[model samples]
Every structure is written in structure tokens, then in C-alpha cells.
Target: MALSPKTKYNIKRILPFGVIWLILGALFLTVEHLALGNQKNALNSAIKLQPDVVLFALTGVTIIGLLVGCIEVLVLRPLFDRKNFATKIISKFFIYFFFFLIVILITYPIAASIEMDISIWDQKVRNRYFDFFLSVTNLSAMIQLGFSLIVSLLYSEISNNVGQNVLLNFFTGKYHKPVVENRIFMFVDMKDSTTIAEQLGTEEYFKFLRSYYGAFSNAIVKNHGEVYQYVGDEIVITWTLKNGLRDNNCIQCFFDMKSDLYKKGHMYLKKFNMQPDFKAALHFGQVTTGEIGVLKKDIFFTGDVLNTTARILGLCSTYKEDILLSKALAHKIMLDNNYSFKALGEHRLKGKAAIVEIVSLLKNP
Candidate 1:
């Protein structure tokens, strides 16, 4: 079967790892060849660069990558979403142990079979099928390979936690210092957030928030929204101007998040006795984007646009509206027919002398 969208996205996130292990595999081959120290006969040298060996090494690397990637995305992603640090550490230890062993079992057999064939064909070494299997199960090799797999998998867990793009920017220094760029910001917060938190009590309410954000994450990725910050009960998501306007993605991401959470209403009601509903405010403008920190670096946005977008969302409760958009953002696009808009009229927002036009965006009846 073809990969699901989520699977495809996770795989895309893990693609660079394939090259990482490919390099390691090549290095391992070079080291092994050099370890022979001029003792190599023709067959030994030939065995070192054999096409079958290259395929075996690369294939093994790829299988380990996919195995670790899938585990990180499908299994560990949800596991880390919970608030308990102690439980996560304990659970991951056992989970990874068996999972990596299973990966070894599935991949090693085929590789070992290939190596046996290559040996007989090229070096005229006679080895029984069982001997090939035994070589694959060699204690030292398995331990070293398994250690590498565990280390790589653990790195994946950390990378996933920091987020894919955030890690990239950290290494590439894409925004080491502030740089101005046009970005669209969507400020989304739970409706009646205070009342809901009180009703659910502190612990349950936090869990609700976690689950709610988890639901929102899927929709944001589906629409290509990049999350900038989470302030208290609100989350600030952003996009490049082009990406935000490409297919009305900024507008659609809000509704999609709502739909996802709505579908989980029953589960929320059963567990927390409440379901979440969120309101969003959107605006497009210039912002300074870059990484900042002395001890712990992080990618951050700074500009009036960020402040203005927050103020737009601050009006949602005042206007009693679910979706609000700045006139500047609305004017840039030819909205699809599925959407309808209402002019909220220009208003002089607090702390601003000039009036800013606003609109309510809604689905067509």
C-alpha cells in the first residue's frame, strides 16, 4: 500500500539520516579494508569493494533508518506528548530494546545470505548456510551495530522533540541574527479558556491542553503552518507570505484544527468533561526572524506584526467571533468560493492612533 500522508511527512523528516548512515557504512568498509594492513590477497581486496557488499551495507543502513524513523514518528511522538518525564524515559528504554532487536532480525538474515553468496562466488570460501547465519549473529558485530542503532534512534528522538525545521535552522544558522521578512501569523487560543480550566481543575485541564495542542499540530502540518511560539493558552503559528497565501492555507488551517478537535469531542467529554473550541486571528506583515540566546539558542520572531496579530486575536472575544482577519491579509488573496467574508469596519484599536480594517471570514452556507 502507498504511504499515508503522515507517514510520508515523517519519512521526509528522516531522509537526511539515510545519508548519515551511508557515510558511516562507507567508513566502516574503508576501515575494514585498511585493517588488513597489506595482508590482502586478490580475493580479500575484491571482497572489500564487491558490488554485493556495497548493496548489503547500504540496504542495512536504510532499513535501520526507516525502522527508527517509524518508531520515532508513530510510537515515540505520542509517548512524549504526555507530561510525565519519568514515565517517558522508563517506557522508551524497553520499547526501543525490543524494537531494535526486531529490526535486526528482519534485516540481518537477507544481508547475511547475500554475503554468503558473495563469498563463495568471489573468494571461493566454503561456508555452510548455518555458518553464514552464525556470522551474522556474531556477538561483537551485533553489539556494535546495535549500539549504533540505539544512538541514532536516540538522536532522532531529540531531533523530533526540537522540531524538524528548528533543528535545521540551528545547524545552518539560517537566522543567527535578526532578518526582516514578510510572514503571516495566526494567533489561536482556546475559547473560554479560563472558565474551561477552572471547570476541569488544574491537572485535568493541563492534559486537555496537551491533547488539544496535539490535535492542532496535525492540522498545522497538513496546511504547512510553522509554529512560532506558545504563550500561555495561546499558540502563535506562522508562514512565509507566499506559503500563507498559496491556497488560502492560513485561513484553512484554523478551520482544519477546529474540525480535528471537534472529531475528538467524545473522548474529551469522557475524560475531562469538556471539549475544546478555539478562535483565531490572522494578519500578514513584515517581521524580524532569527535565532537568539546566549545559553540556549532558539529561533524567534520579533516585529510589530507579531504584536498586531496578537491584538487582532484579542478582539475575538470582544467581537464574539470565531475567525478574524486583518484587512491587509484579506486583500492580498482571491478567496475561494467556499469562503465568505463580512466587513467588521475599521476601528482604532487600543494603543494605536490609526484605524485598521477588520473582517470576519466564514464558510459559505
Candidate 2:
């Protein structure tokens, strides 16, 4: 069986977590090897440094990393998804640290037994394990381990907060300078946002938007969309031309978002006393992408495609349509019988001399 795009994306996201831990573990091992190479304890017991022991330690750390990454992604993230940044970092750190301690307690004894060529239950191996932890060396090692774990957790938090793609770009300097590329833009805006805001008031409206965005995000992820920005009740999603056109992912994303929102209608009605409706417009063209801002930098996209998409979205109320797409994008998409397209005819978009063709996209009943 083939993996879905969403599943592939998730595995990609979790991979870095494991890699970070593996690197840190190697560094920790190197420091320990150098600092305590064949050193004698207060008991005057000397242990030789063997390749198998080092390999076992690395394997243990790798397993711990993969397990922790899985727990952080599948369990911890969703549990604290709504919490503030500081809260998430602090809470997750302690939780993961506790698990780390448990892993160390179990694995250290086994590692000691391997080095001594004895059963883990042997009295000599038991004494060696306890003595190793009670020593000043273990104190220093624990401090190093704690610091390393905190750093790894921070990376995970920041990656989740800023988005994985954005963080990778920042690290890889992929868009350090402006570069032009063809891309597709989707401007999704909630209908009657002002009315909803006023009806719900400030705090309630903020909560509503959180719920609204959260509900729609899964579909975007499933369809492999990169979120560009969120301004008020409007979210800008962008994709490489190839990614957007593949299997008609761009169009499918909009419909999937609608279905997801509809499924959560009861929750919305109960919480906000209203169900949210939205409109989206899609367009494709060349855009210049680069890092921008001084004190705080971000990957910014600049192009007429974005403005054109927003303008097309503005016409949604006029046409009484929920989803609209440019003729260029519509032509590029490979649609099946599940989708229906209606020609809304070419129209003069705002701040443009040339008329652009537009069409409505609908799900077939």
C-alpha cells in the first residue's frame, strides 16, 4: 500500500527530531570518552572502553530518540496544541525528562552488564551501575544530558510554531536572497467575518478563529499545502506549481476543508452560536520569495498572483460562489468526475489592465 502525502509529510517532520537526538548523543559520548577514558573510580575499579559498549550506548540513544519523537508528535503535541509557547516548552521538557530518566535507569544496568560480561542481575554489575550514577561523573553527565534535551525540545517547539518548511528554509538559507519561481496561491477567507466578529465580540471571536483555523488545517496538510500567512480571518496558502497540480491537490484541498468545517458544525454552533462559512480563490503565476524583516525575519512571497487571487476571492460574494479559480489554474488541474467546473467568464480584476478568466469550482453531487 502507498502512503498518503500527509503521512509522508509527517514522517519527514519527525525525522529531524530523531536526527537531532542522534547527533546530541554522539556528542555526549565523545565528551564522556575523552573525559573519563579508562579512569579509575573511588573504588579503584577500572573499566576498559570497548567498541561494543560504545555501539550499544549509541543504539540505546537512537531508540530513545525515535520513541520520544513519536510520543511528542502523536501524543504531546495534540494534548498541548492550544497552550502558549512557554507553557508548551516547560511542560513538554519535564514530561520528556521523566521518560528519559526511566529509560536511563533500565538501559544503564543492561549496558553495565554488557561491559562486564555478566548478568544484569549480578551483584557486581548492580553495584557498578549504582556507583556510576552516584559518582561526580554521572552528575556532570546528567547536567549535559538535561541541557541537550532542552535544546532538542526547543527546536521541536520552534519547528512546530514557525512551520517545518519555514524553519528548514531558514536553516538551509534556501531563500536568503530573492528568487523567482512559479507557484499557486489560494486565498481562503471566511464569509461575513466582520458580522461574526461583532456578534461574538473580541474574546469569543478570537477563540472562534482558533477553532476555525484548527478545523481547516488538517485538509491543507492532507493536500500538501504550505500556509503562507494568516491575516485576520483570511489565510493564504501557497504551493509549488507541481505540488498544486499533482492529482488536483489544490482543488481537493478546498473541498476537503469545506467537508472538515462542515463536520465540526455542531461544535461551532454550540461554542460560537454560529457555523462558519468560507470562500477561497486560486491562481498561479511567478512569485519572488525571500527572507525579509530586520529584528524578526520571515520568508515573504511577493507577486501579482497573490493580489489577483485575493481580488478573485472578493468576487465570490458577487457570484454567490464558495470557491473560485483562475482560468490558468483551472486549465492546469487534472479533475475527475468528483469535481464540477462552471465558467464565470473573463472579468477585469482590480488594479489590472488585462482581463483574467475566472471560474467557479464545485463538488459534484
lDDT of 2 by residue, 1-365 (tens): 99987788878777777787778888977766687766453232323457898788777777777777788887988999888988988898888778767876788788778878999999998788778777765666567667767777788788888899999999999999899999999999999999999999999999999999999778998898999999999999989999999888898899899999999999999888899999999999999999999999899999889889989999999999999999988989888999978999999998988799999987888
Tens-place lDDT per residue, model 1, 1-365, is 96754666677676756655666666666775676566364232123445786787777776666666666667685667554655665576567667656665555444544656653334334333234335533453456555556556556656767777888788678898778999999999888889998888899888888888888878888888888877778988999999899878898888899889999999998998878898999998888888888898788888888778788888998899999999988999688889988999987787777678999998986
Candidate 2 deviant stretches above 4 angstroms: 37-49
Best candidate, TM-score-wise? 2
Q: Please list all clashing residue pairs in model 2, or write none if there are none.
A: none
Evaluated against the true structure, the overall lDDT of model 2 is 0.85
